[model samples]
Target: MNLAENTLANADFMIEEIKKKLRMATGSALKATKLNDEQYEDLKDIYEMVAGKTQFSISEIEAITTELGRLRKA
Candidate 1:
């Protein structure tokens, strides 16, 4: 293959590898987590507010619950 073709193939491989790693990380995070009702409610509220208004990240929701829980105990 030519240099350009080889470079494109390498980029595609890297992209697929990144996507696989992300999927594994997300699945691991979900498997390791257990959210209480309050956290679920908070997540629900967040989901509603940003349902179509913005892009949602699971880690952000996790961070919100973690921060809120810490705040409540302080």
Candidate 2:
């Protein structure tokens, strides 16, 4: 494949990895917190930020990481 294709493939791989992490974290957090409204809202926001309304992108993954950092501090 060409350079652009290679880069896109790598990005896709990373996005999938991030999605897995998000799924596990969100599920564990919800289970531990018992799906409280606040926690659910947080997870929903994270999911939306990471995955967007229709699709996931590299920028959205970066935004998700940034939001996770903020959440960690809070």
> What TM-score does prediction 1 earn?
0.31
Candidate 2 residue spans exceeding 4 A from truth: 1-40, 48-55
Predicted model with the maximum TM-score:
2
**Candidate 1's residue-wise lDDT over 1-74, tens digit each?**
23123243433333333335334343223210344445444434433343334443788656544543442343
User: What does the lDDT read for residue 35 in candidate 1?
Assistant: 45
- Once fitted onto the true fold, the runs of candidate 1 whose alpha carbons sit more than 4 angstroms away are 1-33, 54-74
lDDT of 2 by residue, 13-58 (tens): 4344445755534422213223334533564555445553555567
Alpha-carbon shift of residue 40 in model 2 (angstroms)? 4.7
